[model samples]
Target: VLLGIKMSPEPLKKKHGRAAASGEKRSKRKPKRKETFSVYIYKVLKQVHPDLGISSKAMSIMNSFVSDMLERLAAEAARLAHYGGRATLSSREVQAAARLLLPGELARHAVSEGTKAVAKYTSSE
Candidate 1:
């Protein structure tokens, strides 16, 4: 049953085609190069703990975590923009997305930091 609707199961049929019956596995794509956000992460880490050192493995994990978070934020912001009948994502959408994704004080801090960064960047230009 799907969504409260009962469904009958159909017998599975064997697929016959060169694409399916070739018996040859598709070649795996080459792996992407490891992207390191090490420099930026290290800078922040240093700020938090002056003498702290991070391992390459830790850096890799941090990079993956940060990249994943940023991707989710962008996707959420895009969704917010689309929900509001807009084609382009703006700062407000991003801020709203952050609030939705982050918990309480974290969202406030993130928004404040982002605002300050944007202000500094705009003023510098």
Candidate 2:
């Protein structure tokens, strides 16, 4: 699904190396930390439900649920991609993510809206 997003799956290290050899200075940006979708979902879920009983079993269940939710959110985001191209996720993406991440919970509505509102402000380039 991320194929058409034009994102490079591999780091452009060779390109950077060539540029450096040619006396071109790279921006020196920090490398991006690798994260699985499950990890991303876990963090969001943890933020939403800070005290989910505090047991290993409970944490395991939460992780499972978050992974499931991330799958759902990814599907929704893929659907919404029909309206946009390889752009950064927008309000729609957040809504989709929140809906899947916190279904039937009171925080869902607020988080969904908040994601959109925050995206609007932060997305200005």
Candidate 3:
């Protein structure tokens, strides 16, 4: 006795919309992520106030504040470098920019801390 049955010799291929239509395989790659300033904000908040908790709204506000400050500082630093005709912006330009951006005693404190940080980083290298 003989019964007829038919099947393709090739295994079935898994189909993706565009890839299948084009006869192309999907790439196996992880996506790159954009940088966020919130991580730095969280770290500093944790250090300054270990028991403190921040609301989402408050965190968002802080994120914007930090971002705006950085932008202003960078702009000022770049302007200083351009005015000085330097190809590279040095720590001195950054310190001057901080002073111009910040006011009075706060400016002095920030400059001092920045100087110490730069010195430590250079010494380590």
Candidate 4:
């Protein structure tokens, strides 16, 4: 009887494996890199909607989503650069990739914003 129920007459077979040897060398895996964007996401959300509140769970989801989106965008931009036979990624390739990825007025607005940002950054240096 097992747990007050009837059991099979034959006992379960035990699985066998080599026991761990204390002196044996084991392979070590590299630590995974963790990307965090919670604080940045929260700050941006607050800036855009000052009166709105975001739950911690929602913020975490948004952070992951935004990080993934940015990574995809950068990867697409790099692909565009490669397609253009250039080893280095440039602003032009990024702009072209953004235009290809974004639609209509959004593309225009994004390009303009990017241009403004580049100009500001260059002027600061």
lDDT tens per residue, model 4, 19-59: 44554454566899877888788788789998988898898
Better TM-score candidate (2, 3) = 3
Alpha carbon lDDT of residue 114, candidate 1? 90
Which stretches in model 2 have alpha-carbon errors above 4 Å? Answer: 1-53, 83-88, 96-113, 116-125
Alpha-carbon local distance difference test for all models = 0.88, 0.64, 0.86, 0.83
Give the per-residue lDDT digits (tens) of candidate 3, residues 14-109.
Answer: 665545535446777687985667788888999999999888888889988988998999999999999999989888899999999999999999
- In model 3, which range of ten residues has the least summed lDDT? 16-25
Best-fitting candidate, measured by lDDT?
1
Better of 1 and 4 by TM-score: 1
Across residues 1-125, which tens digit of lDDT does each residue of candidate 2 receive?
A: 47665555885464643556453466788889854444555576679997653555666676777678668777776666655674576666757656655648744765756877787888985
Per-prediction TM-score: 0.70, 0.39, 0.75, 0.67
lDDT of 1: 0.88
Model 4 TM-score relative to the real fold: 0.67
lDDT of 4: 0.83
